[model samples]
Target: MNSEEVIALAEQGILTILLVAGPLLAIALGIGLIVSILQATTQIQEQTLAFIPKIVAVLLGIVVLAPWMINHMVQFATEIFANLTKFVG
Candidate 1:
């Protein structure tokens, strides 16, 4: 493919990755921030305290967002595959 086509594909790939991962990452970050604030206020610096909440939040986020994530990925894949002949030539 030409440079423009390659760039477009790369941009789409990156956007897809961001769309799929953004929610879980945001959930983890928000949980971590809240935990850190709580730790600072209460002086409870348990190593697992920060981690467990973030893990749980991310897992829950994934569970809740799975369908949307899958839809986005499938759409991206479908677009790429549909244009396969154009790319091949």
Candidate 2:
């Protein structure tokens, strides 16, 4: 592919990644921040306190968002496959 085509593909790939990951990342960040604040206030300082909640939140988020994430990925994959010939030649 030419440079312009490569750049376009790269941009699309990044946007797709961000779209898929944005929600989970945001949820994790929020959970982590809240846990940190609570720990600071209570002086617990337990490592697992922060880590476990974020992990649980991420897992729950994944479970809840699985369908949307799958749909987005499938759509992107389908588009790429449909455009394969153009990309190759």
Candidate 3:
């Protein structure tokens, strides 16, 4: 493919990745922040205190957002495949 086409594909791929992963990452970050604050206030500095909640939040985020994420991924893949002819000589 040409440079512009390659760049477009790359941009679409990155956006798809961000769309799929953004919610879980945001949830994990928020959970970690809250857990850190709680640990600071309560002096319960156990590592698992932060770790477990972030994991749980991410898992829950994934579970809750699975359908949307899958839809985005599928759409992206469909677009890429549909454009496969343009990518080849």
My TM-score estimates for the predictions, one after another, are: 0.96, 0.94, 0.94
* Candidate 1 wrongly placed segments (more than 4 Å): none
lDDT of 1 by residue, 1-89 (tens): 89999999999999999999999999999999999999999999897889889998999998999999999999999999999999999
Reference-based lDDT, each prediction: 0.94, 0.94, 0.88
Better by lDDT, candidate 3 or 2: 2
Instruction: Indicate which candidate wins on lDDT.
Output: 2
Poorly placed runs, candidate 3 (over 4 Å):
none
Which parts of model 2 have CA positions greater than 4 angstroms off? Answer: none
lDDT at position 51, candidate 1: 88
Give, for candidate 3, the lowest lDDT window spanning 10 residues: 45-54
TM-score, candidate 3, is 0.94
Clash counts for the predictions, in order: 0, 0, 0
- The lDDT of model 1 is 0.94
Across residues 1-89, which tens digit of lDDT does each residue of candidate 3 receive?
Answer: 88998998899899899989888888988998988988899999798768878888888888899999999999998998898888886
Model 2 lDDT per residue over 1-89, tens place: 79998899889999999999999999999999999999899999888878888999999999999999999999999989999998999
Residue pairs whose backbone atoms clash in candidate 3: none
